[model samples]
Target: MLDLTTGAVLWCALTGLLFTGLWLWYDRRDHARLAALRHRATFHCIRCGNLYAAPRAEEPAPCPKCGHENTRLKF
Candidate 1:
């Protein structure tokens, strides 16, 4: 009877740990995906009326169609 009780408690603890690990893994993956998306700066060229995205938001990126430097579009 004592052995059976101990086994049940061990199994419950193992299941809880497994769920916690899976939750943490998924949370980290989602955060990384969102972080990558947030780094891309969207731009719109007034000269050629073109819209595009480039890495980093602090600087200007040249328009691919018109070769015009455009500041990052504000939200």
Candidate 2:
């Protein structure tokens, strides 16, 4: 029978809790990073003169209107 009252069980629970906390922290960090990148990116299409916003990862991507390459605005 598996004993839930043993030190092994306690250690396992603690490890699980630690990993869960770490995962949550990293998830929040990634979300913040993505949000910042999204805000930093301002795309402008010279071909169609269309201006839009996109994520940094999607920079140098095609414009939604004319399918032309977009230029990212820098601070």
Q: List candidate 2 stretches off by more than 4 Å.
A: 1-5, 39-42, 45-75
User: Residue by residue across 6-72, what tens digits does model 1's lDDT show?
Assistant: 9999999999999999999999999998997889998999898999988875468999999899998
For candidate 1, the per-residue lDDT at 62 reads 92
Clashing pairs in 1: none
Number of clashing residue pairs, candidate 1? 0
Expressed as tens digits, the lDDT of each residue in 1-75 for candidate 2 is: 657679788888999999999999999999988777656578888898898877678778788899998769776
Among all candidates shown, the one with the greatest TM-score: 1
Q: What would the C-alpha RMSD of candidate 1 be, to one decimal place?
A: 2.3
Model 1 segments more than 4 A misplaced: none
TM-score of each candidate structure, all chains considered together = 0.76, 0.47
